[model samples]
Target: MESKDLKFEEVNEGFNIKEAIDEAKRCLNCKNPLCVQGCPIEHNIPAWIHQLSMGNIGDAMSIINEKSNLPAVCGRVCPHEKQCEGHCILNKKDKRIRVGKLERFIADFDSNMGLIREKLTPKTRGKVAIIGSGPAGLTVAGDLARDGFNVVIYESEPEPGGVLMYGIPEYRLPKEVVRREIHKIEGLGVTYVTNCIVGQNITVDEMFDQQNFDAIFIGSGTAKPKTMNLPGNTPRGVIQSSYFFRMVTLNNNGSVGRNEVPVKVGDIVGVVGCGNVAMDAARTAIRMGAKEVYIIYHKTIEHMSALQTEYNEAVDEGVQFLWETNTKEFVGERGRLKAIKAITNEGEKVIPMDKILLAIGSQPANRIVSTTSGINVDERGYVITKERPYGMTSRKGVFAGGDVVNTPQTVVLAMRDAKKVAAGIAQFVDAKKLLEE
Candidate 1:
């Protein structure tokens, strides 16, 4: 059976006060608190839960805000099963406390009640320019701004939330929630320059020389989509998962419309790859009124990189999977997709498909590094950083983190990396000023 129709209004409604309090009571308040250790950003899980248990909603939120700037976003998307919740001692008995749900509860409660953090002190530390408005960029901006740094973020997209705004689906994370979190950062004196591509609109030297930024953080994530070099690849119906998702989810007041739609009703969609992106594409295709959605992967089900919960949800929503399959070519007629020529574990086969979405992988866009010197990237093109200053690139005052420095990982993991980079930037700025004095 198909799961409930996922509208734009968030699929998982966060816990209410009563439900949150009741659930918070489940925590035994372990002295060790393995949940905190398991957390990527090391949020004080037990302390927040303890506050929630005593009906201290604001106090609970205060505790969460100390570490996380995007609590609502992280609570919604983080893989708690593999991190915080997975480490709960209570899980030994299969009754672990729902930490992620309680976190979302506290964050949503704070926002719904218009509870905002007090404004920060004046920007006295140093000026830092952050490239990208993704989780990593936002994390660095928020953390540095709290330390009294003048921070500005340059985002290529029209919206400021980077992946939170465009890459992530609306069903999983509401756009309003992301906007609220960004507003909180803005209230802290961090400025955002939207529709401003750092390399294209402005150069790195300009940020340092003209803008007089003391330091730069490159958090522009991997955006170039990877594709299989196959026959008949030039088809009208072929699209990347990222592009399809944006076209489907972000158009016409945040709903799909007929003015310029990527996929149409009754189309048979075939999605390549078996990772989280592939699952998101397949499920989104189904939501867009596709007659059938198939997830084609070259690997077995066991080797699929998608999270089990996401995989299970897609299966529950009627997304079919073809395992151990390799596509040889995409056959089309009159420049439109018609069918896919493939080979399964058994033999050759042909799957008729009206539309195809590629979700194999992504690579870092070379725009920023290509136009700048002294910034070093690995042979694979990922930026190389130092261990001493903790995320500083070869360029003295420039730093890099997130997908620009490493492979694309989870959102919280990117935040974790950015947290360290923020600390490094603060230290570097302080030392530079001291030397000048």
Candidate 2:
């Protein structure tokens, strides 16, 4: 109900027909598009813009589909300022052609109009099992399913879309958009088995031996939230930003009740860290009617990991910034959070806060690797992936990408990793089947 009190509407809106066409027309269609080069997936920026400029929306969507399995999601969440738009020749002129908005427009237009019904490729290649339905998992499933591989996504959650469905806030990326992307992937002939977790209900070995899967992909993005072992610890009212994001989402979507959300109305919230997650937590707290929301970071603004735009918006939305501040201890009353003892550049200060959201960072969960052997991880628990196979694990026929293989990354980056892993899975499965023949 508190989350509902906060509109929870998507922040960015796609361009309308006229605006989209105008923005698309602004593109010079450079022979060597730096925007494409900047893109992790290297989408043909000029071509798609040209298509959109000419009013061929369907054609534009087709070109985008070539490189992205989650164009809509990318359009909504990708850090275009650091990537495509940042490289745009027009950005120097302060007139970058809203690439993200254009992409979002095309995707939204296509989805709303049912303009593209992709020809489903028959699953004749081989069976592939995908763990987690996050960006990485969805990308692998979509890519492989398109290549004639039978893909069955095993999601531990009741619904698919892993992190996309949970970690991200509704205001940033609406659940409907994630659902739409998952539906499109499903149309590619990918099967989804929800409430079934790998490494638990079924093991990677079971997927190969029992289910007859030729290859398996672990796209389980970092689920374990990292927290600092600080002084004056108390359990209640201290929440991980990831957990807060999930609970707020669940509460808003009616999946969970008000009692589940940690940040109550009129509460004073302090989020530790200054990444995008911190910004989200602070803003969400403000929206939830927090008396005050502060972002406490040990470094200055220049040292913050969150995008400049996000910081600016958070400030505009009334999020207070406690720069160069290090949290020393959690001051709690009766095992409940009451204040935070922190030291700042000026001097030591104690801030009264009801909930302290840890937006520090996260590491991969050992759940999947613990149950399956041969999948080696580093001292830090990241899966060891081979370069040749792109994202292949130490175990043959098993692959990993996204946060599990590398550090936790942006959705598009995870998608990019998953795409490479999809190619690797295809290659491995084909070679294995050939040898059997």
Cα lDDT tens digits, model 1, 1-437, are 23334445566778878999999998999999999989999999999999999999899988898899999999899999999999999988988888998998888889889775666878999999999999999999999999999999999987798888887888888888899999989988999999898788999999999999999999998888888899655678888988987776568344546545677878889999999989989888877778888999988999999999999988988899999889898988988889999999889998899999999988898999999998999877899999768899999999999987888898999999999999999999999999989
Give the clashing residue pairs of candidate 2, or none: none
In the range 181-241, model 2's lDDT, one tens digit per residue, is 8999999999999999788799988888899999889998889999889865565888998
Q: Name the lDDT of candidate 1.
A: 0.89
How far is 20's C-alpha from truth in model 2 (Å)? 0.5
In order of listing, the candidates' clash counts read: 0, 0
TM-scores of all predicted structures: 0.97, 0.97
Candidate 2 local Cα displacement, residue 248, angstroms? 1.2
